[model samples]
Structure formats: structure tokens, C-alpha cells
Target: MTRISHITATAYSCPFDKQHQLAFGLGSNVKRDVVLVRVTSEEGLVGYGESHHGQHPTAMAEIIERGLAPLLIDCDPLDNEGIWERINRQQLVTHGLGAASMMALSGIDMALWDLKGKLLDQPIYRLLGGTRKKTRAYAGGLALGFLPPDTLQAEVADLLQQGYTAIKMRVGDTPARDAMRVGHIRQTFGDDLDIAVDAATRYSLGDIPEVIRYCEDNRVYWLEEPFTPDNLEAYAELRKRTAIPIAAGENHYGRYAFRSLFEARAISICQADLSKSGGFTELKKIADMASAFHIAMAPHTSHSVLSAAGNAHLLAAIPHGILFEADVAKVNPFRTELAQPPFGVVDGHIEPPHGPGLGIQIDETMLERYPAIAGPCYLPIERSAGPTG
Candidate 1:
């Protein structure tokens, strides 16, 4: 049996020149530091994972190196589920279930899966019962912030021209502003294109009526995160009042959290993040539950290549998988210099990469060039001072 010999973590910062914005937050031009994990077995097999250190790279790294690594040094590398359970059960040092812990576990779990795929000479999706279809994608977080009307129109046109059938725009800038943008996009795209809005937890119950009206009037596909994560009553209320389906779950942590959402009938679409929602293990359970409820899944992705690939595989396995989020922000390594030239985007829809594990071949040398930098590269506008204003 191959026992784990060492677990190593390093951090890298990749700059994004464009300032991306949501209703509640903003990201300035900077190279976000991403924490990478490498697990080496006594038999010399190596598996890699990524922790998307958006605003907490240092903290995530500290937890992985100082806290989680100690637990895995002499353990069996193949016992992924057992190891995850043990870490979850840790009374004092077992904080790897949520936030930094879940982030760290995501990397570790990915590495384990990678190792398993390599050992068996099969792709992770194949090991997970093969794919149902070539994964389809949608434009995600691409058209956000308050841009000039003409500029926003051009962006939507470009995405449509690129062959995207569906696109999500950031809402909650203000109901009036959001209405104007949504109306403009709907008018331009007509009823054929699928358009969705992300309120990003910026709305109150007071804002829901107008927002729901805007979505229905414009034939919007779904409305996401209209209320904060804890406000399930608000979600249920909003769902009852609106014909447009309510979508959420990106901010939610694990299956337990999702069970609450399902029980309340708070969501029609679930946007689970593979990296944050306890990796493949927890996400699989969440997807299964959504299937039972007949809820559609469109996973949230804006982290690293590993997350994108992992989501693609996971989405492939699910019956109700609809669209994958494609970060259309230019100048980010995700769109530019990361991995190989074609990061699997084809005619606006991304096809899953056909290789082992996550099927993402990261450029290690590029990672070395961009050592981990401190602070969040993308700070919310309020945190970014007056420039965003």
C-alpha cells in the first residue's frame, strides 16, 4: 500500500487587470494568490490541488501547512473518505470542514482523485461512472459592475457572437440600474437567449417585488442570491411571489446547509462551488439531493483551472446539469496565460478536457514565477476606496 509521505503547499499570485464587480464586492487589478497543494506518497506518486485564495491565501496556507499536513504525513493516501472524516472529527485541530479547512480539503481531495486516476489509467469522470454528455457552459460573472450602456451592449453582443446561448449578469447595483441593464440585454437578445441575474445578496424583501417583476417581464431564466444566505424565509417568500425560479447556494457550505434550502423550497437552481462545498464528496451529495427535488444545477466557478475542471467532471455526472459558469474577464490568468492556450472554451460552451483526474495540465513554472502575494487582489469597491466610485 502506498502511504502518504509528505504534503506541501505553495502560494502564487496572478494579476487581473480588469476590475470585476458584484453588488456586494469588487476586485481591483492585482494577481490573486492561489494556494496549491502537492501530496507525495511513499511510492512516489504525486497529486496536486488548488486552494483559491481570493482574500485568504495566507490563512488557508497556514491551516493547510501547520494544521492539516500534520494529520496526513503518515496516513494512507488512498483512504480519502476516511481521512476526510477523521479530519472532520478532530476536536481541536480538525477545522478543515468549512472555509479554509474546506478549501484545504478541496485541494487534498483533488490530489487524491488525481492520484487514483493515474494509478488506474482512467479519467476521474470515468472512475465516477463516466460522463453523461459533453459539458455545456454559460457566460458567468462576465458582464458585471455598472458599465456604460453602450459598453454593456457591446459586451453582450460579443458574448452572443461568440456562440453563448446563456449569460448571467450581475444585478443589485440598484433596482433601477439593474432593470435598465436587464431590459437592454433582453431587448437586444430577444426571447431566444437565456439570461440570468445574480443579485449577490444585496437585496431586501422590499427589493424582491421589483426584481422579480423585472425578471418576469424580461423573460430572465433565473434570479440568484437575492437575499443573504441565512434568510431562507425570504427566499421561500420570494419563490412564492415570483414565476421566475429562485437560484442560490454558492455562499452555502455543505450538504447540511443545502438540506435546509431544499426543505424550505428556497431554490430552484443550485450553484454549488466544488472548491468551497467540501470538494467532490459533499458536492456529489448536494447534486443527488437536487436531482430528487428536480432542481437544476449551475456550479459557481471563478477560482483556478483545477476548480473549473473538477466542476466540469462533476457536472457531467449529474442528470440535471444545465450550464457551467465561464469567467469572461480578460487579462485574468484563467483566460490568458494559465495552463495551455485553449482552456477548453469552444463556441462559448466549454467541453470537458479528456484526460485523467481534473484533466488540467497546470504550468508549474508559471506558478513559480508568480509567488504568493499578500492581500486580496480583488477588493470590493467599498474596500477599494474611491477609485471604484
Candidate 2:
């Protein structure tokens, strides 16, 4: 049995060619952060994966370099689930389930899966029983925000021209503006198109009802993270206000927290990020829970290719999988260069990686090209007002 020979986590920051000015949530993404973890087998095989940096890439990398790597070094890489349990029982217990710890473990879990697929000489999807070759995907653009109505309409039109049947646009710029954008898009495009609005935790307690009414009247596919996951009570109440699917989970870390979300009955769709949630190990348990509850799933993908490929494999294997989020940003090196072949959306759907492992080969040059940029990449809090639970 080959044991994990070496493990290291490196942080990278890729600045967008132009800053992404969002109406809310991380208000303007000037740069994207990702902490990549590499695990080497005793035989010299290597695998790569990424962790959601949460605007703190350096800190997340320290957890892997100083905390998680030790637990994994001598362990068998193929005991995928067993290694996950060991990490949970050891490091996670000692560190507590904080964002950095969870994100760090997620990176490790993903690397092990990539290594496993390589070991088995099969792609991750094929190893997971190969649910489907391609899964339906929607354009996920951070640029679609509280811009002018013409700008917003033009953005939608351009995406549709690109063959995207569905798209997600940012809301929470005030209920009136959000409502008008949704209504205009629906009126212009008609019912055949799918439109999802992500509030990005920019709404007040009072804003919930107005947004709900708008979604109900206009047919918004899902109101994503209308409020932060911390406000479970608000989410439960908001669920009663509308029939449009309430989607969340990218912020949620593990299955224990998801159990609470399921109990709350607040979310109709669970949108976990593989690199943030718990990678394949814990995600399988979460997906199983969603299946039992009949809740649909839509995995969130930012700019990390590792997370994107990991998400595609999970989406393909699960029965409840609906769609995967694909970043449509103009400049995203993490999405383009982190993986050798990168990810592509063909015919409005993404074809699963056919390569062994995450179906991605880690490009070492990204380490030199992107490096780490300092300061917060998310929106400044003072710039954001209204209730934040």
C-alpha cells in the first residue's frame, strides 16, 4: 500500500484584468484567491486540489502546511474515506470546525480523490459509476449586478447568444432594482429561459418579503443565500413567503451543519462548493442526505479549476444533481490555468473530465505566475449596509 509521501499547500491570487464590480457580496472582486494542496504518493504520483480561500488564502495554506499535512504524510492515500475520518477525528477536533480548518481539510480530501482516480487508471466519474457524460450548466457571472437596465439586458442577451439556456445574475441592490431587472429579463426573453438570482447576503429582514413577492410574480429559479446561513430563523420564515426555490450551502461547511439546514426546511436546493464543504468524503454524505429529502442540488463553483472539476464528478454521480455553476468571468487564471486542459462548456452543458483523476493535470507554472496578493478580495463591510444576521 502506497502511503502519502509528501503534502504541501500553496496560495495563489489572480487579479482580474478589470475588477468585477458586484452590486453586493464581495462587492468588487479585484482578485481571486485559492489555496492549492498537492499530495504525492510513495511511488511519486502526484495529485492537486484547491480550497476556498475565503479571502484568507495565506491562513488557509498555513493550516494545511502546519496542521493537515502531518496527519496525511504517512497515511494511505487510497483509504479515501478512512483518511477523511482520521483527519476529522484528529485535526478537525483539535482545531474546531472553523472556516480555515474545513477549507483545509476539503483541499486534502480532493487531492486524495484525484490520486485515487489516477491509481485506479480511470477518470473520477467512471470510478463513481459514471452517471452522465455531460451535465446541464448555467452561466454564473459576477458582472451581472445593479448595472443599468440596458447593461443588464445586454449582458443577458450576450450570454444567450453564447448558447447558455440558463444564467444566474446578482440581486440584493435594493428590492425595487432587483425586481425590475428580473421582470424585464423575463418579459424580454419569455418563459423558455431559466433565470436565477443570487442575493449574496445583501438583504434586510424586511427586504425578504418584497424579494419573495417579486420572485413569485416573475418566476426566479432560486433565491440564493438571500440571507447568510447564520440566520436560520429568517430563512425558515422566508421559505414560507414564496414558492421560488431557496438555495444555499456554499457557505455551509459540513454534513452536521447541513443536517440543521435540512431540519429547518429552509432550502429547497443545496448548493455546496466541493472545495469548501468537505470534498468528496463529506460531500457524499451531504448528497446522500439531500437525496433522502428530495431536495435538488446545484454545486457552486468559483474560479478554481480543481473545485470545478471536483464538482463535475460529484454532479455526475448523484441522482439529485440539477446543474453546475460555471464561472463566466472575463479573466480567471485559477479557472483557466490551474488545470491543464481547463474546463469547457459545450452545447450549454459541461462534459466531465475524461482524464484519470479530477480529469485535470495541475500546471506547476501557476505557482510562479499568480503567487499570493495581500489584502481582502471581498467587498468592504462598511460599503455594505442593511441587516446582517
Candidate 3:
């Protein structure tokens, strides 16, 4: 019996320079942040998982070390559902920690699954009864933001050359400018290229009609998070106005919120982040639920290769899974240097890791180099544009 012996959530940050910084609907990204969750069992076997920093690495780390670790110590690492329920009942429900609790738990839960896989000497996908297979991927991450049309087109062309047939660009500038960016890509690349746009939960309901007009005219693939996660009505309303698929769920917390998305018939595509949406335990249920409603599954990739590998496994295991968001940010050490064989696109698709657990090896020494930087990863919306004067 492998019992959990110890758990730690260490925060890490990698700052971007002026050359690599990309500004989108949310703000300009200055740094990438992630909480690396490590779980060890009594026998000395170790497993790793990642939690999104939630723009506050220390805060998320504190939640894991101080808030969650006590509850999980001595629990069976193999019993993922049982352990998940224990935390769900104790912290998430009773204390009302909401998304913060869920996000922290996401990492812990992911590590436990990794532990379970290592215990049995199997990959996470095999543990979930999934076969090893490739899933379609798109060029995403912090690149392709609100750049000038020519600059954005050049970025798209580069991703195409890398073998990605599909790409997601950032939007949520003024409606006219946003349309110009979308239209430019479609006109430049023609219809063979698939273009999806993410507004980063930055748009209001009033901003939709015009955006929809351009997306429709340009044959855009989908319009993601045009409004915040809580705005179910806005999503449902937008669906009525446009044929372009509405994709969301990255910021949403658990299956319950996703269940609401189904009941409302709000989105045609679901993009849950495994690191933020309660990890594999909850996300598997969410994926099953999505299958019933006929919604496509495209889990959002986070700051590191851990989530990238885990999401690819989940997508491969599930029947309705459609696309994977490959983080093609120009500079992200967390995705490249921190892990080996860095996650990549092969002919526009990615496959689950074949090694035991989440599979890739990590260099703990890398953590020292990227000690957590204080403050948010994104600059404020106004400051992001810089020098409008």
C-alpha cells in the first residue's frame, strides 16, 4: 500500500524580456508563473504536477502547503476519487475557498494520479484506460496577441511553417481593431488555415455583435471566452447571434460550473485547464459530461510541460476530445528548459508521453533559477498597450 508521505508546492516564475512580451485582452504578459506540486509516497517514489499561479504564486503555494497538505497526508495516493472527495468536502465546500482551493487541489490531484501511475508502472493515459494516440494541436500560448495586422500575420506564418495547421490568436481590443486582426489572418492565409481567437474574458456583451460579424465573415474557427466564465447568459446570447463556436472553461473551477455550461447550451467547445479545473479526477467527469452534450473537448495548456503532457493524455483517453492548445510562446523556460524533450507539435498534433506517470524528467536545480517574482504576471490593461500618447 503506497501512502502519501509528504507534499510540497513550490512556486516558480520566469520573466520575459521586452522582445518576447506579448499583450492580449487580459494584459501584457511580463512573466510566466507556475506552482510545481511534488508528492512523495512512503516507499520514496515521487510524482509531480503543476498548478497555475493564479497570478499570485506565493498565495497558491501557501494554499497547498498550509491549507491542503494537512488533509492529504497519510492518504492513499492510488485512491484518487476518495482523496479528491475528502478535500472537496473539507476545504472547498465547508470553507468556501472556491476557485483558489480548486486550483491548488488541481496540482495535488494531478500528482496523486502520477503517483498511482508510477506505482503500477504505467503511463497516466493507460491508467485511465486510454490508448496512446495523437491528438490535433493548435499554436497557442502567450504569443499572437493584439499586434498590428502585419506583425500578427507574420507570427501566424511562422507557426504554420512549424507544421501547425490550426492557431488561436488573442483578441479583445476595440471591436474594429479586433476584426481587422481576424480579417487579416483569414485574407492572408486563405481558408485552409484554421484560426481561433481568445478574448481572455475581456469583452462585454455589447462587444459581441461586431466581433461576431467579422468572425463570421472571415470563417473564424471559434471565439473563446469573449466574456468572463460567470457570464453564462452572455455566452448563451452570443451563441444565438453567431455560427462560430463559443469556446470557454479555462477560468471555471469544477464540473458543476461545466454542468451549468451544458444546461445553458452556451458553448460548442470546452477548453478546461487541467491545472485550474480540478485536475484529472474532476476533468474526466467533465469530459464524460461533455460527451453527452456533444461539446468538443480541448483542455487549455498551462505554464509547464507537466500540464501539457497530462492534458494530452486526457484528450487521448476521451472520445469527444478534439484539439490541444500547444503553448508556442516565444520565450517560456517553464515549457522548454525546466523539462526535457519539451512538448512540441508533430505534423500539427501531439501525443501522450509513453513513460510512466506524466513521464518527462525535471531538473530541480532549475527551480532555483526561477524563484517566484512578486506581483501579477500580467500588466494592467491600460499599461499593457504602452505609449498611446
Which candidate should be chosen as best, given lDDT against the real structure?
3
| Candidate 3 residue-wise lDDT, 1-389, digit = tens | 76899999999888888888898888888888989999999999989999888989989999999999989899989889998999999988876588899999999999988888889989999988799999889999888887888888888988899899999988887777788788888999999999999988888977777888888998889899999888899999999988899999998889999999989999999988899999999999999999899999989999898898899889879988889999999888888887776666788899998888887787787779888887799897663333111
Q: By lDDT, is 1 or 2 better? A: 2
Pairs of residues at least 3 apart in sequence or in different chains that clash in candidate 3:
none
CA lDDT, every model vs. true structure: 0.75, 0.82, 0.88
As a whole number from 0 to 100, the lDDT of residue 18 in candidate 3 is 81
Model 1 TM: 0.91
TM-score of each: 0.91, 0.94, 0.97
Off by over 4 Å in 1: 16-31, 91-97, 382-389
What tens digits encode model 2's per-residue C-alpha lDDT throughout 189-237?
Answer: 9998999999888787888778888898888888899888888998889
Model 1, 1-389: lDDT tens digits are 77888888877776554454333324334555667778888878787776656476777777778878888888877677888777667722444345667677767777777777766677777777757356667887544556656667788888888888888887776777788888888887688889888887888998777887788999888998988999999999988898898899888877888999999999999998876676776778899999999999998885667777777778777778888888776545644556664475577766666777666676776666676677776555543212222
lDDT of 2: 0.82
Question: Lowest summed-lDDT stretch of 10 residues in model 1?
Answer: 380-389
Ranking according to lDDT, highest score first: 3, 2, 1
Off by over 4 Å in 2: 17-20, 381-389
Q: Which of the two, 1 or 3, has more lDDT?
A: 3
Arranged by TM-score with the best first, the candidates are 3, 2, 1
Better of 1 and 2 by TM-score: 2
Candidate 3 wrong stretches, greater than 4 Å = 383-389
Clashing pairs in 1: 14-31, 15-31, 26-379, 26-380, 27-378, 96-101
